[model samples]
Target: MNETTLTAGKPGQSEAKNNKMGRLAAASSIGTTLEWYDFTVYNLMAALVFNHIFFPSFSPLVGTILAFSTYAVGYISRPFGGVIFGHLGDKLGRRWVLIATLMLMGVVTAAMGLLPTYFQWGILSPVALVTLRFLQGAAIGGEWAGSVLLTMEHGRQDQRGRNASFTQIGPSFGTLLGAGFIALITYVLTAEQFMDWGWRIPFFSSVLLVVLGLWLRKGVDETPVFKALETSENKADLPLKEVMVAHWPRLLISGSVRIGSDIMYAILMVFTLTYVTTILGLPRSEALTATMLGAAVHVFAVPFFGSLSDKIGRRVVYAMGALGSIIWVFVFFFLLHTLNPIYICFAVVVGMVFQAMMYGPQASFITEQFPTRVRYAGSSLAYTLGGIIGGGFSPLIMTFLLKEYNQSLPISIFASIGLTVTLLALFSAKETANKPLAE
Candidate 1:
């Protein structure tokens, strides 16, 4: 396709074609949203319920640490997932990889709900949980890049940021769904009941979501970019090798640019969720509710920032978000320190806004850096590697910082440092908003 033809709608194209594109975007978005819902449910459970259920033998602090460590296991496994699935996605196709990932994540997540507890299974309980969590990590590692490519490559070039932003909104909706479900159960159940079975419901419910996601994804066509690559002599025999040899600098920059948003998400959505109720003595329901509200706002914020990137530039919008993280790192903790539910909600919502700003433009920004033949491997590796460094250990690191220093100041500084790396990345990256996919 020529530049003008690919970037803009062809003259006399039917309205049905436009509608199909919209549906494709919706399918990609919804599938990713469900995937994230499964992941977030696990994260929230790890923070609140997993320690008690899976590591009952350990003391409270030890059990919590172990649970978060298990959570980190997912991140550690993501790079392996990225490489394995990324290689296949670039070689085989984006559709089949996504379908396989969805099935794997759904089955593993539901199995988590049915697994025997530490009391019933002895040492085997935590081991099973960790095994499932690792699989979950791997599935997600591949899921994200494929899902973004599905929409972006099919979308008009000028609207790639907006199309990719649809996938970014998934996390917000997923977090909202996961947190809202857990919050509802917590509100309705007694503390004993919640610990007993309330947590399992969310995990068990993932099967229905998986069926829906699969159905939606099955109807969508393969991305035009991947299809084009398949017919071209330019296709690499080893996409990963090509990525490393030809695109290492772009890969490193893509990963570095992700540091700010990933760390911010880990700190705000994961660590802070644990911090408020555990350290600050806030009610569990209150914390989840505040997070749910923030997630609702995030749904809107992602698309807004994404469309803004199409106008100004990806780097500018991303830099704004990184800067927001630096400024809000302290303010977020201060609001939580106030001990008021309203202030707590403000803190979480503001933090999500910053996160959305970076995440919104991120899919197109990173994908645009690489060509279609190696796009899957390149983007997935950069994103999941960033997940490992920036988000994977964030909760564990935050817990350690709080335990050692007994202050949020140290944690804020840690977050600021990650954002600084992102700022440097933005400065280094070429503006990709106007670039064609065939470049």
Candidate 2:
């Protein structure tokens, strides 16, 4: 079979017959939203219920710390998930991997909602929770790369950034949804009611959204580029190995490119919630509200920046965003510490918007670094490595840093990391704005 034989381009159709940015964006957004919903809900739970429900035997602070450690467990599992699914996706097809990842995320999350609490089942409860979280981590590890690749490969080459941004909006959308649900539950019920049963609502509700996403994704066509490779029998024999040898430098650079975005995300989305509600004497609803609003702004900023990348180039857009992060980390933290809800909202929303400049173009930018044959493995490996280094330990580190060096130190450290990675990414990669899809 050849590309010509496998494709049904019809008489006048070229890439346009296969590329449909609108359809791809819809599919990608739904898939991304579902996966992120599963991934971030654990963080929400950690912020609130996990300490009491999963680690009840420990001191409140100790239990909270232990529960948050479980959240980090998910990130640790992501790379192996990437390796396994990346191999399968590179070998089988992007569509298969997408379905598998989504199902895994949905089932694990729903089961988590139903798990016995520590009071009911002893330590096995936390053990069960951590194991389920690992599965969600692994599922998301694979889900993100596949979702981004599907959109990018199926979209018009010229608009890859915008299309990919739509995919990345999954996190922003998922974060907002997760926070909103928790907020609503918190608002309607007392803290005792929320811990007793309300937390389960968000987790269990994942089933419906997952089903819808799977259905939408099923209707989407396989990426033309992957189809072309499969038809030509040109799939890489060992995608990970090949990528390691041939594009090793790029894999490193791409991994670093994501650090800035992920660290900012952890700080803005996860840690800040803890900071405001716990440290500043703000209500849980108020902190979640600010985070939710920031996420809403992030949704818009993601696509806007992604579309901007389509015109200006990935590097220029990303560098500007990274520079903003390096500059804003201090100011953002300062405002949050002020304990004024209005200023806190402004600070977080601004941080999220600046973060979006890098995130919006991220999916397409990373995927474009490799050819179709190894795109799945390469992008997944690089992207997950970034997540682990940048996001996985960030919250924990911030918690530790705050304990030792006061509030300002954590932001300073994170900012330094963002600036370092930004420089490395800018210096290492060529601008990929209008580059033709890899052959």
Candidate 3:
């Protein structure tokens, strides 16, 4: 791996490297596909259905908030999974831990689909939902790091950004698959039918995805980097302990780097569904269609941006994304306010495009902040910490603000704070796009 090989992000890679990466990418994609599928569906259910099924006794607005609180619980639980599984990933290897995380998410998500509503279960219904959501969050927390590392570590040094993009596609494909499935169900089922049993079908379908993921990942091996670490006497040296004691400040900065993107995603993908329906009095299907199309375009855009990061720089692409979002969010709301379907679609598509710029290079950028020894723990901890403040609670906070003020201004203000934090992180952080990973 000399300069030429490292810089040959083009088609000059050996046949062996390409074939190996293709297999790893395929395996990693399926598992992460399941992760985001659950993510999109669960959040949609929390916003649209859970309020009705699990908290029918409360006011509609109050129930939405409570349902979102349950959604928040998952985020709150992510750090635990990050710490527990991150340590395991570094201690053991990235491959098996991912399998475990995949299975955990599958079982827990299916359980949510099987759960009875409040009328049938009394106080147990909502409680059970929260618990399941927590486990789902934990699974995702661990899955992200392993997937990113598996691809990044296995691929050529120059191609890390593109390789990591495969992992990033999880959300794109998962959101598409999940949203498409939900949309089909909603289109065919009557409100009564959807409320009764249709919602459960998606949850139960997780088993099939988990099975597929297991088969694909079964043949995948541990990353060469981790295998090398295993041969070393230190073997990363208590990854979690090393990360926290020596790299606490990095955690804060890396975590805050996510504040903007998370806030943007929460608004465009999550909160917009609620906002369009409840605030603007738009049809539920309209909002869904907008986001579905937005996510669809992202499938291509994400990879392109990832490749672009290799050419220009990771920090440049990353900061540009945050800046674009800060400017575009206001436009997103304005378009939605028009109540024109075409503009609505445009707004959301552009919104997702901004996300593509950020998310495309995200895995490599963040993971590069840590050395090989502490990467799993440091990266995972930073990721979950960002989740807690950014994606985890942004929707809930925005919803409360909307209810309190009857305006979108507060929402924009809050999102700006998240993006601002990201810019600050980029300013303080070193550019790692052209650099080799620290040993």
TM-score of 2: 0.94
**Stretches > 4 Å off in candidate 2:** 1-20
lDDT of 3 by residue, 292-312 (tens): 998899989888899999999
Candidate 2 residue pairs in backbone clash? none
- Backbone clashes under 3 angstroms, per model: 0, 0, 1
lDDT of each: 0.87, 0.83, 0.87
Q: What is the TM-score of each candidate against the true structure?
A: 0.97, 0.94, 0.96
- Candidate 1 per-residue C-alpha lDDT over 1-439 given as tens digits, one digit per residue, 9 for 90 to 100: 4322464455667587778877887778876788789889988988898889888777765667788899889988988889999999988899999899989989999999998898899899999999999999999898899989988888778888998988888888899899888888888899999898778999998898889889888999887777767767567789889989999999999999988898899887888778997899888878888888888999999989999999999999999999988999999999999999999999998999999989999999998888878899999999999888788888888888888898999999999999999999889989998766645
Ranking by lDDT: 3, 1, 2
Query: RMSD of each candidate?
Result: 1.5, 2.8, 2.1
Question: How high is the lDDT of residue 141 in model 2?
Answer: 85
In order of TM-score, best first, we have 1, 3, 2
Give the clashing pairs for model 1: none
- Across 118-203, the per-residue lDDT of candidate 2 in tens digits comes to 88999788889889888888988888888888877766677788877888999988988888877878889988898898888888
Name the runs in model 1 displaced over 4 angstroms. Answer: 2-4, 7-14
